[model samples]
Every structure is written in C-alpha cells, then in structure tokens.
Target: MNRNDTPNGSPAAPQASFSLRQLSDADWARFGAGEIAYLRPVTVNGVHAIAIHGADGAPIGAAPNAELAVAAILQHEMAPVLLH
Candidate 1:
C-alpha cells in the first residue's frame, strides 16, 4: 500500500515538487518519508511490539499495538499502512 504523495493512502495526484519519472538521488532517498508510515510486528527485548517504518523503508519508531501506532502516525500527519 502506498500513499504516493498524499499522506492518507490516497492515489490522488500530488502537486509535484519534482518529476516522478526522473527522481534524483536525494528525492529517492526521501521517497514517501513524509507522506506515509507503516507498521511491522516485531519483538523488542522479548516483548511483542509494532515497529513503525517510514516510506523510505527505515524504522522511525515503535508502538505496543496497532491502535496506538496509527494514532501516533496520524498525530504526525502521516498516513499509516498495516503490514501483514
């Protein structure tokens, strides 16, 4: 699931700051970093937890559950995607 440029998982075209076809290195590195977040189940120190990842496929934070994770993502104005 991707939000593309929108922060709510919407496919609606964004007001492009730059061309999508020829993304530069810096833009590619920050791909989706601001618009989307995702959740992955993980165990931290033997305790089950949900890991939050940015659109760039990097870990940003963690939450104990999906509900709180979603809330946190929303609070930060980023769309959340749940990974199975």
Candidate 2:
C-alpha cells in the first residue's frame, strides 16, 4: 500500500493553506511614520553591522547580522525593512 493511502486505499487528508495579510494604505502610512523599524548597514569599530532605525531617522538598535536585526525588530512587534 502507498504511504499516502489509508487503510481502505483512500487518499490522505488535505493540508490547510495559509496566506499572509495584505496591509492597507493606512498601514503603509503608519509604517512610514515611524511605526516600524528599518535595518541599515553601517561600520562600527571597523566591523560591519546592521543598525535598526526608526522611520523618523532615530537610532533604535543594532545587530551583527540582518537576520538578528529583523528578529529583534519583530520581537518588538514592529515591521523591519532593509535600507539602501
């Protein structure tokens, strides 16, 4: 018998699908108004690091890598975006 088949040869159970939430224009405006966190690259003491900044250009925090920086921002319930 196939692994996907049940005892009676029926197909396996259907899996649930999930989709991400789509932000509205107001939400994007909020994010642009310092309601979110942005990740930027910088040099600290001769070492490259990721710096977290608010939408108003204020320093929020820093991390050794982009992943950790994003995680830190998410932990604070804020959205993270990479700054060029």
lDDT (Cα, tens digit) per residue for candidate 2, span 1-82: 7988889999989664733257665654455665578899999999999999987667989999999998898888888988
Best candidate per TM-score, number? 1
| Clash number by candidate, in order | 0, 0
Name model 1 segments beyond 4 Å from true: 1-29
Cand. 2 TM to true fold: 0.60
Off by over 4 Å in 2: 1-34
